[model samples]
Target: MDRLPRLACSDPRLTRLIAIYETLAPATLGALEALFAPQARFVDPFNDVSGPAAIRRVFEHMFETVDAPRFEVLDAAIGAGGGAFLLWNFHFQSRDKQRTPRCIQGTSHLRFDEQGRVLLHQDHWDPARQLYEGVPLLGGLLRRLREHLAAR
Candidate 1:
């Protein structure tokens, strides 16, 4: 099993981003029914969903495959210089019975709505290195490289 300590959902900005991810990961449609702006849009490598319902659906799909997932904000910087950014690491196990937990890094660029809901969320990460390569022998190699990169 793998664990990534979650962020404290106290600061309003971090709270919103954390809420979006949590509701998405577990497909907790009800939890997000009123959380987003009616015209909000969310995009990622595998999903480009608009409006709350569509976003909820994308999350539902994610829950089907990802198991026991957690997203941790390793660090964050915010100021008038630009929008807030969270340096995050995502960790999860696959639903595949034999798989171990997988970890990946991403940078989340966030903007708040007029009401402080997360309006735009752009995630930057490489699916090829973070996810696709996490399969068996290929995964071993990726893991080795990832560890090497981390050590540096």
Candidate 2:
């Protein structure tokens, strides 16, 4: 369990959205429409999509690829103009039994419609280091490349 940061100004919509994310599951994906507008745009390292249906597909693929995928909201804040930001960690295990569990720290910027449903959702995270760098062979190559590219 993660501790939620105290919000300076509590927005019910943001609160509810966080709850949805923290408890999100395959069965509960249908609830996305309640949090996202019909034409909401969602973008991440590997996906750029519009509309709730497409967003749902992205999440569905996550479920298909990983075991017990979940999100822990570490911190959140509501902007003065109905926008919001969420800092979170995505936890999951690879379907491959040999791979250990993994966590990806990320942040999301969200803009809401007048109705409090999200219009835009953009995720910020580094997949090269957080994801690809964990592969056996590629990981070693990437690590060596990072070392060579290091400033100091």
Candidate 3:
């Protein structure tokens, strides 16, 4: 953690984004638009959406699909050209019969506009291991395939 670059408190945009994520919920989902520009783009393992409305829908789906999804920022950093990076964990319980809670480790790369609103947000994560492998039927098959591959 010591080696990770800390986002300065002065960076209001990034700070606010972090704050909202830490306390994110269905009601607060609307506020996420304030953190991004009107035409901002967001990309993740399963989504490629542009604009605040589209982005909000993704989060909405997350909440609707998962039991209790939340994000925890472990570290953050600011880069040149108003860019930022956030290392985080998404924890949730599957809505299916597999009600066990799980955690997905991921990182987000963000580019902000002059107003400190995000222009582009891209997330990096492994859906196969973090999500699909947790499913009941698919999980077993995926786990077996993973084991076979690892043996080689």
Model 1, range 28-79, lDDT digits (tens) per residue? 5666646667777778887777787887776676667788777677766664
Q: Candidate 3, which segments miss by more than 4 Å at Cα? A: 1-10, 147-152
**Candidates sorted by TM-score, descending order?**
2, 3, 1
For candidate 2, lDDT tens digit of each residue in 50-103?
999999999999989999899888888877876788888999998775768999
The CA lDDT at 52 in model 3 is 95
Better TM-score candidate (2, 3) = 2
Query: Could you estimate the TM-score for every candidate?
Result: 0.70, 0.91, 0.86
Residue 28 in candidate 1, Cα distance off native in Å: 4.3
* lDDT at position 85, candidate 2: 89
Scored by lDDT, model 1 comes in at 0.70
Candidate 1 displacement at residue 16 in angstroms: 4.2
> In order, what lDDT does every prediction score?
0.70, 0.87, 0.87
For candidate 3, write residues 1-152 as lDDT tens digits. Answer: 22335445567777899999989999999888778899999999889999999999999999999988998887887887668899998889977665888888999999988888899999999888888887789999999989989955
Worst 10 residues of 2 by lDDT: 1-10
Provide the lDDT at 74 for model 1. 70
- Name the Cα RMSD for model 3: 3.1
